[model samples]
Target: MSSIKAIVDQKLILEKMEGKGGWTFARVPKTTANTGKSYGWKNLKGTVDGFKVECSLMPLNKEYWFMPVKAEIRKMVGKQAGDYIQVLLYAEIQELHTPEDFLLCLQDDPQAFEHYRKLPDDEKQKYIDWIFATVDEELQVQRMADAIDRLSRNEKLPKKVLSAGKPA
Candidate 1:
């Protein structure tokens, strides 16, 4: 874990490389840049301008790391480009919190449970996060059952999990 202070003063400029769209980013404070590199995209929990955010730092180049200031963060912080945003970051080892319903469904199917156990940590995290993102009880149950069915049949999940209200 590392801590440092710096201001945010970059514009949300879009970049293009030979006509391909690029990311919108804010540079990591120079003092904290090295810390992000050392962590190599590990989970980070920190406060930016008093707003709590959890995300992985992206390497911008050899000299800096950056985090995308998405529309949600921008609105929450109420700061625009060039504002002096304060940040305090700490590296964290996040534990996967699979939803209980999802786990129960998997537990009932031995084949699914076996395949799920074989998934890499990061892949498993995606499934858990997908479940966590579901806000409705009924949809969560359906998705869990769908996931288990796919796993049991050795079928791949969709590239991304569909929202609760969306069909899979």
Candidate 2:
């Protein structure tokens, strides 16, 4: 089930924090986003200065919220840390769906399929989204292959892929 929350629009500076894994994001002031993270992490989909964005609004100390700006999005938008941007966003509870191709790959490897089935929804969603995100078909295939290998071994997903890209 999915539900859309209130919409928000605000100008935010893209800032970076040093200690906490060097996160780069824009703060969504509680004043602006009065409803995004009241329950927990809320998945958001909207636009940042006209560029499409789908992200999670993470709550901090229940005071404010921060939305991470991924490096890929930064490059596409040609914005760097400290740049001000107009953010138009709305939070939603998303329902995760397994991709057919990804499912086919897993079905071939019973152990991997079993592990994937037992994974938390977020973990499963990560793999599904990452595998489908790349426009390059070869990269997508490789991601699926790597995922199955890691899953069958009962290992944490490849850190590189988990973060942004496949490890070189």
Candidate 3:
């Protein structure tokens, strides 16, 4: 079995995906300038989690800039482009969180608690981590639970609990 290699950094991965629109690696034959003879090959590379990757597209799209492949090849492993053609790099996956998990971390302030409940999963975790790092542990736990309870009751946190503090 072949294993892929990658570097894992949340921020960096996001940045690369944003810049490239997706990830892809390619290999092409090199030609001699004078005789037009094939001199071997050259590879184009990209990454995810710091690992090099190659993928095949489900169907061929010749006009598209990127093509999909059967399997992804990282820097550590090598694969011929024609071996299993049709590769295209797609968008990166983002992490999601559940309401229960979100609630468990919002105990610091009921209003901030409600504010957190309304946020998207990614934003909620970012905020939760920020709050957890700065507030007292006990308060963090309490706020998380309180936020959950408020949701269950279909009620919002009081205005006092929503005040902002120094950055975490």
**Each prediction's RMSD to truth:** 9.8, 10.7, 15.9
Candidate 2 residue-wise lDDT, 123-151, digit = tens: 78878877888889999999899889989
* Residue runs of model 3 more than 4 Å from their true location after superposition: 1-85, 88-114, 134-168
Ranking by lDDT: 2, 1, 3
Per-model TM-score versus the true fold: 0.46, 0.49, 0.27
Clash totals in order: 1, 0, 33
Per-residue error (Å), model 1, residue 35: 13
Q: Which of the two candidates, 1 or 3, achieves a greater TM-score against the reference? A: 1
- For all candidates in order, the CA lDDT equals 0.63, 0.81, 0.38
Candidate 3, residues 99-167, lDDT tens digits: the string is 454544454456656655566554455445544554576666666665555545555444445555222
List, residue by residue over 1-168, the lDDT tens digit for candidate 1.
323333233333322233444444566745554432343663566666778887667666765667766657767988755565666666544455666767888999999999998886666765676655668878667667777888898766676444443436
